[model samples]
Structures are given as C-alpha cells and as structure tokens.
Target: MSGRQGAAISRDGTFDAFDLCARRATLEGIVDATTLPRMADGVADEGGLARVAWRIEGTSDALGRPALEIGLDGIVPLECQRCLAPFEGPVAQRTLLLLARDERELARLDGEAEHEVVLASVPLDALELVEDELLLTLPFAPRCERPECVGAATAAGAAEERTSAFGALAGLKPAPKNE
Candidate 1:
C-alpha cells in the first residue's frame, strides 16, 4: 500500500513516541510546495512537488523525547542570486534531530560545540515536522550550478556592479581635517 493511502493525519492526531520507537515506524507523503503556507514564499510560483520520507525508531537518545530522522527529495525553482533569473535546483536533505525532554538536557546539548538538540513536547505534529525539514533545506543565496554560469552575467557581471558597503564608505573625506 502507498505510504499515504491512509487518511491525512491532523496536527492534533498524535503519534506515540514509545510505539514509534518500538515499531520503527516509517511514513511517506507528498507535499505540494505551492500550498504550504509557511514554505510557499521560498519556492517559485511554478511547479514544485516534494517527496518526503521519515522514520522514528528506538534509540538511546532518551525517553519522553522524539528523535526523528527526516529525508527530503525534490526540486525547487529558485531565482539565481547572480543573474536574477529562475532555475531549478535539486534538494536532498537528510538530518537527525535529537530532542531533549527537559531544559537541563537541552541546555547541556546546546552548550556542546558539536551537535544540536531541540526541546520539543511529545506527540508533536507530523506534518509540521516534514515542513520544518523542507524549510531548512532551501539555500540561503541560491545560484545556478551550470558551469557556463561562472563567467556569465549571473556571476562576473553582477559582482562587478555591486560593491560591498565598506567599499562604498571608503571614498569618504575626513571633513577638511577638522580645521
């Protein structure tokens, strides 16, 4: 059966942390980027479909905390930062979020220089989880990957037209030496 054959799960229909971990639950779904309110703005107004896969399995991370691994595969249309033209970019994101039950543990993990952990309540919204991962996968300043792009207007010409703020300020005079 298709992973999404069942009725759509609501934000209130909760998943049991214990059952998920015990059964190693796996779920899949499709998200039309154009319809997701929180994420619609980030993608182009054109075609955008996301295939999502997620899993929650038993792990020693802790109890009362949901450790979810999310995988995202899709293509998002983005405007090139250099050329200001639109292009399709491939996205494949896989991440592990270590959730902490209390502030103490959250703080401890935050203080660590290596990994990140979130403080989330159990029975969290499943669709929200998928949306969060998708949002995180977008590029901050998307640029086309075409090799021809290197010396094209998107790259060289644009760089030549825009100067750093500091560079622009460097031309200032010293007020006639304050004489």
Candidate 2:
C-alpha cells in the first residue's frame, strides 16, 4: 500500500480496513467526479475532479475495542437548488468507527457507544467511503452564496412581481350578474 504522496493503496479501490488501521496508512488521490457514479446524481455537471485524501489511524475507545480514525476532505461540484446554478462544495469530515468482528459485535458496539461501528470487513472500497463522506457533507439544499447568485435571486423576484397570480384570470371576466 502506498502512503500520502504515492499512488492509491490499491488499483481496485479496495483496502483491508484492519490492516490499514494497524499500519496507520494514508491514501490520497485525485478522482474525476464523473468516476463516482452514485455521486453524479447530486452534481450539476460531470466536469470537475475531486481531491480525496484520507488516513486511517489505530485507536481504542472507552470500551477498549479496536477502532479506526478516518479523516477525509475533498471538494465536489454541486448544483445550487435555489438558483439552479453549479457551484463547488467543500467536504471535510472526521469519523471514529469501531471495528466489529461480526454482526453481533457490531450491534453490541452500536448499542453501547455513541461512536459509529462497522464490521471489520476486508477489501472495503475506499472510493465508496470517500463518496459517502462527501455526500454526507453536502448541504440538503445547496444554494450559492456568491454575489452573482444573490443578484440572480433578486432578478427572479422582480420577474415574479411583474407577473400576477391573477393574470391568467384577467382574460376571463365574470358573466353578467343575474338580474
């Protein structure tokens, strides 16, 4: 497996979770946004690359169970829900996940601790992890905060004011009142 400055830990995007944690390994790479299929639905356009950098360090929680500290950061292109414009959203996340040997252990760890717990499964897909973290960090309804977007919003409101809700009814008039 490679370190921070080298190639990805694995070409297939999978890695041994326990082994990485034990070795305190770091994997950093740049992946085109288009490569992440699931993430495509959330992005406005498939025209940018995301910088994925992560590291797994060994740790022990209060329960003395094996744990891994994952630190991830990246930037993803997203469409502003308000203006329908594309923008860049930054992702920065850190999580401590307890390694559970089996489903029973996973349930037990989850019930006992506030930290997240995952099965210590081998060959975990690193890209999927990165994608998940990035997705979580994204805003539920992203809106561009730039001055241009603000101006666009103002223009939209003005356009709305020029049109009336009753405009469609203006063409039709009430029939002559019954005498």
Query: Which model scores highest in TM-score?
Result: 2
List residue ranges in candidate 2 displaced over 4 A. Answer: 1-11, 62-64, 147-179
Q: Residue by residue across 1-179, what tens digits does model 2's lDDT show?
A: 34552332567877676766665656655566556778778876754665556655556667666777767766777889877878887767898778887888889888976887778765667667667666777788889899888888899988887676567577587777898
lDDT tens digits, residue span 78-157, model 1: 77777666788777887666666678878986786344465654565666776777778888888877667656855665
Could you list the CA RMSD of all candidates, in the order they appear? 5.3, 5.1
* Candidate 1 clash pair list: none
TM-score of each: 0.67, 0.69
In terms of lDDT, which candidate is strongest? 2
